[model samples]
Target: MEGYETGAGTARQAVKMDMPADQPQTPIDEVIRTAYDNIGLERLETVRALVPRVGMGGLSPVLLNKIRPLFKHTHLVKDEYLFQQDDEVDFVYFPENSVISEFQMLADGRTIEVAVTGNESAVGISAVWSTSSAVNCAQVCVGGDAYRIEKDVLERELTYSRPLQRWLHDQINAYIKQISQKVICNTHHAVEERFCTWLLMLQDRSRKNKFNLTQEYIAGVLGVYRPSVTCMAKSLREKNAIDYVRGQIFITDRSKLRKMCCSCYSELPPRRVF
Candidate 1:
């Protein structure tokens, strides 16, 4: 616990590496190397911050301390399924720099992304109030670290904290808005516009301009064919808005990319919730 800081009003300790430092190495660095070398303290700080979507933004420090122990840090890989449709909701995931996509499965074996979650929001939050199975498949679209708390543990904690409960409800409302916008965008916008919007959203969540996304993956998320994604990528590259090589896509000109996006881009949530 040497590299960790105890919350101001609670005995709970959280990783403190997020603090800015002028020196390249300090006493905190030494402690991190000695005590938390294997955990990657920087990545583990996702749970330590008062992130809004994680439902810790406005809670009292004492309440945060009581529920902090319920969370377990996890590293999620791209394309890994956090929970499949119809599966029992076991845990809720709080992505740090990672990105998770909730896909609605169709009977024709197609999957379309309904919502994308990042540090601004959590995944599988519906489980907090319902004991039913998952409705959509939640998968890690970008590989990175996250924190997860068991559904039952979070449910129990919510029962004791009104602030946490209100936070969760707000997150749910935001999530619904996101899904609704996706529906409108998919129905009314062109594929090129939708593609640009999707890329921007991914960049917003992952905090990276370059993404290791294959055309196949993009097609699946957009509910389009591989050839269509290929065509759209080619157009974006020709316009100098983006560049793609093999499985990677790079946002080369953000301004140009934004220009290509439809109205949906502006309708989406801000980069940060709090």
Candidate 2:
């Protein structure tokens, strides 16, 4: 926090971080090292592999080392507030091993997640688009590491670099597809449909059928009571729709799940949720 400048046009407060030779490197250290090795990072090694439907093999190697140097490594523990509502946006983050959720609280005191970003996605669009200071309440749901850059620097790179710009467009398009599907699901699907669709989406991202979860976390995202999440999860399991144990939910019956899920899952053709 000390010896830092908040903003200075395209310029950022730069400082060298020392890795002590005496101390062993942490997991965060390894992620940083691996990121340098693989321009295209595989999803499994990232910390955010806990969630489903978030598997992203990001960046081609040529671009990986090229762009990797532009980013600074950052870490956030679980449940930590990354950015509060109305905070100024300085850095745009591409999470390598973390899951960050963007949500808004309603007047009735309910919170709804607008987007859950990790491997395949980019964050801080409003900063680059609006060029404004204020930001929304985006928190860390899963603890992990990220590559961060100043907003101005990111925009400048996107503007002049055609390859980076194309990559940005592709990433943004993926998110647009997701948000569009979520809208359709929220409006027309039944509760069971919505639940399955959500689970399937999570699975696709995390690249795993089994994941750590709490009923309360599901309830928060679904905008329902904790008990409701438990009951519904129980319902799905009883019907062999899924298997839940020790914070792990496994979908054993994909056939039944797709049947039970709304058209959003099957009809829309998700990117990689199979």
Candidate 3:
């Protein structure tokens, strides 16, 4: 616990080197040392401020204190896969300003995103029900930091904290609702409308107006042809709703995007059973 901090105003501590000065370093150790040298304490504090954005905002102090010990703060890069389908559920991640997409692969090798969860939801909710494997592939669409906890520790804590259990259940229900709505949207909505809805949803989740996403990735998530996504993106750019260059996109006119989106954008309300 020498390099760990648990409090309201402090950032989690970095790893302290206790080995002898002449000790040989492993490849992994060298990488970690480099990372520690590069990431400043101020940046870690900035990340700590975003932790409260995870899940419901009213977590009891007792519950937070109990669970904080199990969390390991780490950064997630864009396009990184947290868990692949059928993989053993080892950890649950609480993202902060990170957009995670749950995608189900089809028989024809195509993938379709079932849900997009941000700070308000935690990935690997299957651990709550004691599931042994991942149901879908969870990938980070927007790069950011997150607190990850081992599934065993999380399960133990969930068993002891009723508030935590209830909160997680509600979050899981909200995620299920998102997947259900997306299913319907993919089936009935036009490609352009669905694209707008997806973009708006990503923006809301990441709380950022700009994104580094390729058209191929967008098409995969939307379950549409890449050419179709290219066309739609171009049209949106022409309408001044967004700006796209290479693989990056920026929302230039949010009002126009809102107008172009279907009612489904706002219809999927976040519900709580607690």
Candidate 4:
């Protein structure tokens, strides 16, 4: 059995840090001011349009316009690290078309995905009240466009906006629910069932039928051996639930895949947190 060793090493090597250690960190206030200055009318409109779509429907237009300047559009790539474990989160990412996965690394160096964040919610929102350092490692699972705001800027806005504060608390509750369910699924479900559930969840977040993911990567995310993923993939293919060639996986039959998935799949919020 090829355990997490090889897969984990590959993930570690593939991680592209947003900020390099050699680069001097800019002051947060200055970064915010610069982003504010660079904000264009079109960009602000784009951000405002995305707000309601991403579960912030209650935010007033006035509030949205006020903070629109604080946002900076960002394009993230696959395998990019938003923030590593124990590192202070400098920005909160709101993925418009991207999917971000948060993993908890074990003492033995193994890791398992605990939560996934996509367009429905933002990542690193816990930085509002939680510790400065991140508890899990966050990485881009599917690459695309996203919007980010400086942590300090978001914190400052939260102080006076009761709606925003309530929304953040609701998001945090949903996050906790997802993580708790993941634990139950990992502990009680079969690998095949879990694989099906994961595929459905990924498809929901990425809004794509096909994904560029390898068996090793799937194994690492599930904390299983590479061969286990291979077997499960083969089984899924035989059932016409999915199809894969090398690093690419395509959902061939959504109905069949859903049938094979565990109850956990139906339990998750629809078109919301994964």
2 or 3, greater by lDDT: 3
- Model 4 lDDT per residue over 1-274, tens place: 1221221111111112233233248654334323322332224345445544542222355765777788899999998999999999999998876889999988787789998877767899888766669988999988988889998889888998887888788778878888999999999999899888888677666656677787777887899878888788778776767776657777666556667888887666444422
- Number of clashing residue pairs in every model? 0, 13, 0, 0
- Overall local distance difference test of candidate 4: 0.72
Residue 135, model 2, lDDT: 43
Q: Which ten residues in a row have the lowest lDDT in candidate 2?
A: 1-10
**In candidate 3, which residue ranges exceed 4 Å CA deviation?**
1-62, 269-274
- Candidate 3, 136-243: lDDT as tens digits: 999999998777888888888878778988977877777778777887898898989988888767765665667888888988898877878877877887777777
lDDT of all predictions, in order shown?
0.72, 0.60, 0.70, 0.72
Write one digit per residue (lDDT tens) for candidate 1, span 1-274. 1111222121122233333435555554243222322222234345335333432322355755777787788999999999999999888888877889999977898789998988777899976788689989999998988888888888888898788888799888888899899989989999899988888777666656678788778888999978888778778776767776656777766656667889887776443522
Runs off by more than 4 Å, candidate 4: 1-66, 272-274
Candidate 2 lDDT tens digits, 133-181: 6445777766677778888887887787788777777776766776676
**Cα-lDDT of candidate 2:** 0.60
- Estimate candidate 3's RMSD in Å: 16.4
Q: Ranking under lDDT, best-scoring first?
A: 1, 4, 3, 2
* Pick by TM-score: 2 or 4, better one: 4
TM-score per candidate: 0.76, 0.67, 0.76, 0.77
